[model samples]
Structure formats: C-alpha cells, structure tokens
Target: MRSSVRERETVARWDVARPSWPSRTAGVSLAGFRDSSAGPVDVPLVPHPAVTLVVEFGDGLFVVGDATGRQQRGSLVAGLAPGAVRMRGENVTCVEVRLSPVVAYAVLGVCPAELDRTVVALDDLWGRDLSRIREQLADAASWEDRFALTDSLLARRRETGPLVDPEVARVWDRIVISRGRVRIEDLADEVGWSRRLLWSRFRSQIGLPPKRAATLVRFRHAAHRLAAGDNAVRVAADCGYVDQSHLHREVVAFTGMTPSTLAGDPGLAVDDIAWAEPVAHLGVMRKT
Candidate 1:
C-alpha cells in the first residue's frame, strides 16, 4: 500500500502508505508518511471533521503549532477543527490516525468536549502508554505492522473507554451523510430529542455543538473540493454555501487561507494518497 507523491515543479516527495485493510474498529483510519525531501518541511494544517493523532517515530523533530504561537513537539493529538495550525519537521515519519468524533471519546479516554479545538501532547492524555505505543511503532518492521499496532491499541482503549450516547452518534452520522447540509432541527426530530437536549449532548460528546459540527463538515468537503482544483463558485454552491464569498470566509476561518491558496497547499496535495479511504468514507473524491 505504498505510494510516491512528487509535487509538480518541486523536488518534494512523500512516501505515503495505508493499511492493507480497514481497521478492526469502525470510524478509524490510518496512514503513514515519511518525508523524502532534502530539508525541513512546513505545511499548513487544514481543519477537518475528526480528531487527529500523530505518532512520530522517525529520528527527526516533529512540531505542531497553532495560530496563537503555541507549539507541541513529538506526537500530538488535535481536536476536531483545530484552527490555523501548522506542522513542521525534518525527515518526519509517523502513522497518522483520524478518529471520528463519534468514537473518539471511547478511543481517546476523554470527552470530546474537553479537547475542542485544541492541540495537546499525546503524552499528556495517554501518559506512559503513549511512550510504549511509540516504541512499538518504531520497532515495527513495516508500515503494515505499524498500522496493526495502532489498530490494536485503539481497539483495546475503546473496549475500556466510555461511550457516547447513541442518539449523539446517530446525529453525527446524519451530519456526515448529508455532507453537513442536514438541519439541526431535522436531526433533533429524527433522533427524537429536543433541540436543547440535542445541542448539549452533541456538544459534550462530539466536541462541537450541532451547528458548528455541521459547519465543520461542510467546510471539510469544500476544502477538499478546492484542493482538488474546483472553482470556488461551483464548490460553494455544491457544498451548500450561499455564494463564493461564504465559502471564502469559511475557508479563511478554518485554514487562514483563501480558497485559491488552499487549492495549492502541499499538506492537502498528499491527501489523495494518505487519506483516500477516509475521504471515500465521507462520500467525496479527489479529482484525478
């Protein structure tokens, strides 16, 4: 499952790999990346609709920083829709896991509400267990082995961790299935919960209120479409935006970049290879 990505007109290349099969746990996906460039790499981190765990194992420095200038070194966890972040490193190698907010609570041993829009050291949450997992991944012989180790770790954590309310999970699935176009009121009706109850439960369990979650999902879809070279005007309409300006605003809010700049972002360019399965799970595809 190894693929090579070389940006046009540049010497940057990435060795990206994915698991041979899906994770045993649902709502989890993994990808591995090893930088092949001659020097340090810095890429803007685009906001997405899932919690992210980066397990760094290479003999290099890995740093994540937010717009506020806070930085965390080594492996880290980013909450859903962490705004205006960046990743920088030299000779980076890591297995990146994207966990749907629906299951992130169980797998991460913390309420999503607690992680909302923040980046934290994985060691702060997982403590010594994070160290053991990093060692296991570094000792693994191949990317497939690393993926297996990660999946096993997540499955074990999920078994012992608390679960989100079923109603909340249902609403999340609906939001994703509609590509964030579903109304919160409609979701409340479908789940037989009052608007107030739905908002509270969804916010605590999903790390974001229903409307904000919907906006994040919608923005994720539009961002990927823009990254695929779609015109902002057409993408806005297709992704439920009022107009191109609406899409531009959301893009700026989420990534601190205009739609055109995001289209050429190096971080997103590798998504087609690194996140193919997860992107497909979201019912979107990168343009070939």
Candidate 2:
C-alpha cells in the first residue's frame, strides 16, 4: 500500500517490509514501515484484540489521548484499547510487532490486564534495554537486521517471563479458533471452571473480558473484509452478527466510524500491506 496524498492535502507515503522471524517466536509477527510525509498527519486507528509494539526511528509519533491530554510516545506498547485513536506523526520510520494477548505477558513481563485499554512507553517495561535497542535499530543496515535484533530481545524476555495459566491459554485459543463466535459459557465449561471464575481469570490474563475479546476478534475480521471490498451486509452475516445494523453498531463502537467510513480508512487498509506477508511467512514457519 504505497500511501499517496489523500484528499485532505497531506502528502503521505508508506512502505512496508517483512522479515523472517524464528519459528520459536510463536504468537508474534513483525512488520517494518517507512513513512515519508510533508508534515505532521493524523491517522485513525481502531480497536484490535492483540497488543502492539511500535518502535519509531524518525519524527516522533504518539497516540493522541482524550480528556486527560496524555500522549503515549513512540517505542510504545499498546494494549487492547477500546474506541478510536488517532496516531499523530511526521516522516516516521518504524517497526511494529503484533503480539497475541496470550503471549503478551511472557514477552513484556507484565500482565495484559494491567495494560488494559492503555499505552505505555516500552522503556517502562524493558528499562534501559529499550534505549540500547533503539540505538541499535537506528544504526542497523537493513530492516532484516533490526527485526533480528528485536526477535532476539523478545525471545530472551519470553524465555524468562512468567507463563500464563494453562486454562487461560486454552480459553484464549478457543476464542481465536471460533473467530469470537464461541459462547462464553461454552468456553467456561471447556476450561472446567465456573462462569464467574472463568470470566475473572480470562480478563486478568487477556486484558479484555472473554465476551469483549470475542467481539474485538469478530469485528477485526469484519473490518478486514470491508477493507477488502466485501459488502457490509454479507460481512455481518458471515461474521455471525445478527444483521447489518448489528454490524454497524459494532463498527461504530470500536472505531467511532460508520461502516463505509471505516472501509475507506487508510490506516486500516494499510494493515493488509503491513501484516499479510509477514503473517503468511509465519504460517509457513509454523508448519515446518
């Protein structure tokens, strides 16, 4: 997705690159983005089920905050936040990693729950190590080299960080496999826990409660389809929404946009460009 000037007079171009990651790096995928723009720009970002790590090496980027007027900096970790967000930046080059909530704790040494609906500086998680990584990334000769450095760092963290509860992991896997269509009660029963216990544990481990996570996952699928030119009505039906209206509400709730507006959103349309190649590569790695 070569970003071009939009109707709003902002000249923007984004190039995405994929790097080979280790097979042992399960539940994670990496993408590199190079953005060249005339000046500062605002891009809308909607909610997603997974956590994200953004490391920027060019002009600063920050998550635009509401009410409190607090902005999260580049080189940040963002949890499964709700509503809409606008990323403000100019001439940014960065590497982004998408981490499944199941592996977030292991990779970051922080429970997903503590990060619920929030973004924080990566240094807050990895301390001085983040500065060192940023310096190395800035000096790296190629995107592949930067990716390798990041993979090594995350691998070490995952190896040493606390493991998630087995039952919690199982519940998460089921939700993904079902594409968020699975019932909460069914998940609770499958995990051998009462509904109350399952709810508490799942939220603690995965950030969002089971039901909310499922909704996000389902909405993510629908959003991608819409971005791919699928009809909203068909997407709603295929994604298990009651109807187009139901899908509309979900889209509005997560993105603060109507279905048509979200379909035209460049930030989301670029996700395919950013993730498709790396995700496909990761799948092949898993099979081997």
lDDT of each: 0.85, 0.77
Residue pairs whose backbone atoms clash in candidate 1:
none
Model 2: runs farther than 4 Å from truth?
1-12, 59-63, 66-69, 277-288
Q: Give a tens-digit lDDT track for model 2, residues 1-288.
A: 323213211222466667755435688878777765556667775677789888777545545553245777677887896366667776677888888898899998899899887777887898877888888889998877888888888888889887778998898888888889999998888878999998898898889899999888899989989977899999999999999999999998777789999988877755765666434341111100
The candidate scoring highest on TM-score is 1
For residues 1-288, could you state the per-residue lDDT of candidate 1 as single tens digits? 223333421323567777767888899988888887778889876888999999898698899999999999999999988999999989999989999998899998888888888999888889878999889988998777888899999999988988889999999999999999998999999989999999999998999999999999999898889876788899999999999999999899999998998888877876666776543321111122
Task: Give candidate 1's whole-model lDDT.
Answer: 0.85
Clashing pairs in 2: none
What TM-score does candidate 1 reach?
Answer: 0.93
Reference-based lDDT, residue 154, model 2: 80
Candidate number with greatest lDDT:
1
Error of 1 at 161 (Å): 0.8
